[model samples]
Target: MSEKPLESFVGVVGKETWWSRIEALEAAAAEGRRCGWAARQRHAIELTIARLLRAPARAPNAAESEIVHLAGLLAASFRGLAAKGKAALHASLHAALSGDGALTPIFHQMRVAERHRRRGFSVSFAGLETGAAFDLAISRNGARAEIVCDVLSAEDGREVSRQAWRQLADRVDPDLHAWLAAHPGRYLLKMTLPQGLRADGGGENASPAHLQARIRTLLAGDARAQQDETAVLRLDPLVLAGTDTSQHGLLAQLRGDFGPEAHLSVTVAGQGVFVMAARAAREDDVGTALRRRLAALSGARLSGAAPGVLAMFLEDTDLAEWRGLRETLRLEGAARGFLAGAEARPVAAVSCATRAELIGLPVPQSAAGGEVRFANPAHPAARSPELAAAIRSAE
Candidate 1:
């Protein structure tokens, strides 16, 4: 009996040689097969080729020779295709050879498409130390867009410049409605910080509620322009704001309106709120206590009188101590009480987990007319010794 050359070849290549043996098996399957078998063999070969071609170069111990062999096989499969198939094969080859890193280029091309869809235009406004400037542009095919520049330093100047740029950009692409429709809503709302201004904590100075309010304002404008009847303004305070007492309060309010099990994180300084909660809690489930405290102060008002504040009118010592007494809340956490001041004395005072909670309480009025009073109404200096101890310890 004469030996089969392909079978002999496969025996030499061993099962451990996956790439070489796969080729041998494919060649064997193609020889003297029925029409259906031939088609199945071809399909299997094509899929194997694709899988090999798409394998990332970052894979450990991958051989260059194996990759080249796979690429050659794929090229042979598409050598005589018509224009559409050829174009698709070319794009696939480009994507496969470039590996996962090719996504960046793909994204850039999508961005170009997005720009073109908006009547070939884009704009960026960057705030500078001295002032802010708008760079308007008209996109040219396969080239850098042309820029129309304007700068503004004074508050008045910035507003006028912003308005002018808005008018121009609108004429180019009515409110960039097409562009916005293509991108995620959150991306449009992100506030990009200017260089050097990051030292001010990159909008950390704005409370979560404040940031949400700003986003609501912008989204409202977009909705009005689009005349979107079904466009509902969904403000997610927990996601927008860093984890602080204010964020906690906002989350509580949202939960009250929405429901529990809301998968949200309120952050402070861009750090995860879980860390803040962990630091503040004496146990694993202190988050429940924190949420309850936030819910308790849901209707508290803001005063805007101080750089930071944490005002609460709790009758319970445990609630007051747990919510009202933190040494340093992140700027967002503290800004909740920026305007709150008191005309009457606080019944008690103590530091809590975040400064943002202070905004929920009324400022204490002083009996001495200027001195801040910190006696619990139940204890009032003449009453309870434990209250005095708690007050002394707080001081």
Candidate 2:
């Protein structure tokens, strides 16, 4: 806190060293003529460093602290690990910067471990050391608990995937603009995908290309509507009953009508407009997916030698839906249901962390008290003072 945040950060992890590495990755991506995750991540980290340097000479905020935290954590991991352990960590580290993977999963584990360490527990990457399946081992006052930190995307519960929608939108955008230009009329395309619009499909499943072609075909026809086993597509006049006609207003209106589960996009070309709204046949319960992950983790990740903790990091979740889950108690319901199941035998508690929390703002932090915890009172470790920081429930 004494020195400037950026200066202190550079000391923690040599800025030139990492900056050059990221730049090299960026250069490779540029030479390949591809803008992918690696390039994007490199840009993001650069922006973080820039922001930190530009911050006023005051107390550091979430983003500043996060950049520093990542630098220090990564530097330490690189220095401390070796051989198979380092190799395993490298795989994740590479994905953390490249590929279609993300850093949230790795960062979530570190934050959870930090919390335990602050509570006076000796924490280590247990799986890296013992080749165990679980992530971290934390012990306090001789009582140890196994903590498994896992990230689950809300998209996993969707009948429609985000990537599929993105691809579909990209595929149809130019065609829609051309069509809209020729037609010069307000238009809307409503869709129902029983099999779901898939980004990756070689079978009868609805592929983005197939769906895009189908929409084009419908636009070419005078029928303005078509229905089949794969999907139902209808073209109609765009109407916003009482809203403004601007692009922003139209998109907002469509989003409201389609709801959070729907994927909607609007295209405008010289006043000829088109809006596409689509949804899968049924909405998948996000809470159910969380429970499914919990069930899967118990068998695959946990060793069952100690009372285990499941630290759930709900990734790719927006604030609106995040609030909806907690308000409707969907998260609570799913977590409790998992705890009641046989899969929970070795699990002592389930705690949830959100992007907001990981970014340093623990929204609601929950009135249930310290960390959204569901303690398994029946587990022997539940009463252990040492484990209390982790397994004790505010409930």
Candidate 3:
């Protein structure tokens, strides 16, 4: 080979690298801050694929640590896709894994590990497809292992999805529902918009009618619109209100539910479930405890325009005591300002024996008081399978 020909080829190869496309995508995504999560994730997937292809070309045999890290990253990205509801990517990944011998099992393994909240995995790569002329083999610990491109972190992906939902809530200003309740005179909605009308207006130009329209659209889209709308009407303690009408899965898994020293967590639904953990000394004590627990259980952050249903789980032995306690607690809640609206707070208090009993609890027979009503949660398990499994495992 002539030295001149070899030098020209080296320059051409260096100039036309695969990473340039990824760089352009990254820059464009950065330029558009308001771009949706779906757009951002597409760029991420492409960038990751470019990086993976580069890895095999630079060195076919990568360190186990390097492979693990890469695999973990890719797994996270896959999770991000899942979180975004991008079924196409999932289908593609499965198709790629099953049909093409270009990728290894490490991608699937890493995804499994992330789902289970594991740190490391034993990985091997049989073939790494780069679309180049040569087929590459990746090894770990003197064995064949392939490390393909990784996606986002599974945990991070969840956070991203959460943030997206939060953004959507903020854009429509769901908190304004509480504000509207407080200042009804400020923005009067004299004309009622048609049902199924969603809010589209924003800024100072937007009237109260527009805001109401938006709230209506958002609530209507929600599966639990009726319940949430009721809670929004009584939004005095805005910070303590349960904004998230979505299922909480198991309340027991979260450490933030209890005090730092306490190791107890009750697996309540997202709407919130309050267990009569320890009996109170006096009639007044249960009210005090209920208030404190309600505040603790319903996080300060408002996810929507609703107060979480504060259900009290009770055993057969405590029925009579709880019956008397319920009235006293309800009275105390009203007096103490924990319960509000035409609906009685205590009336809404659902009594159940166990989590299983909570699954198919019927609606209260009598609409006796303006008490908050409790019903069976639409979804008992968490949104993510891994998280749902963890909750079940804890139980």
Say which candidate scores most in TM-score: 2
lDDT (CA) per prediction: 0.28, 0.74, 0.30
Q: Sort every candidate by lDDT, greatest first.
A: 2, 3, 1
Of models 1 and 3, which has the larger TM-score?
A: 3
Instruction: Encode model 3's per-residue lDDT on 144-263: one tens digit a residue.
Output: 211122211111211112223223333434344444454442221111212111223222222334434445654345433222321121111212234442224322332234322121
Worst 10 residues of 2 by lDDT: 31-40
What's the CA RMSD for each of the models? 31.7, 4.5, 22.6
What's the TM for model 1?
0.16
Tell me the deviation in Å of residue 366 in model 2.
9.4
Q: Model 3: runs farther than 4 Å from truth?
A: 1-126, 129-164, 174-214, 217-225, 228-234, 239-395
Which sections of candidate 1 miss by over 4 Å?
1-187, 190-386, 393-395
lDDT of 1: 0.28
- What lDDT score is found at residue 183 in candidate 1? 36
Clashing pairs in 2: none
- In model 1, what lDDT does residue 312 have? 25
lDDT of 1 at 243: 40
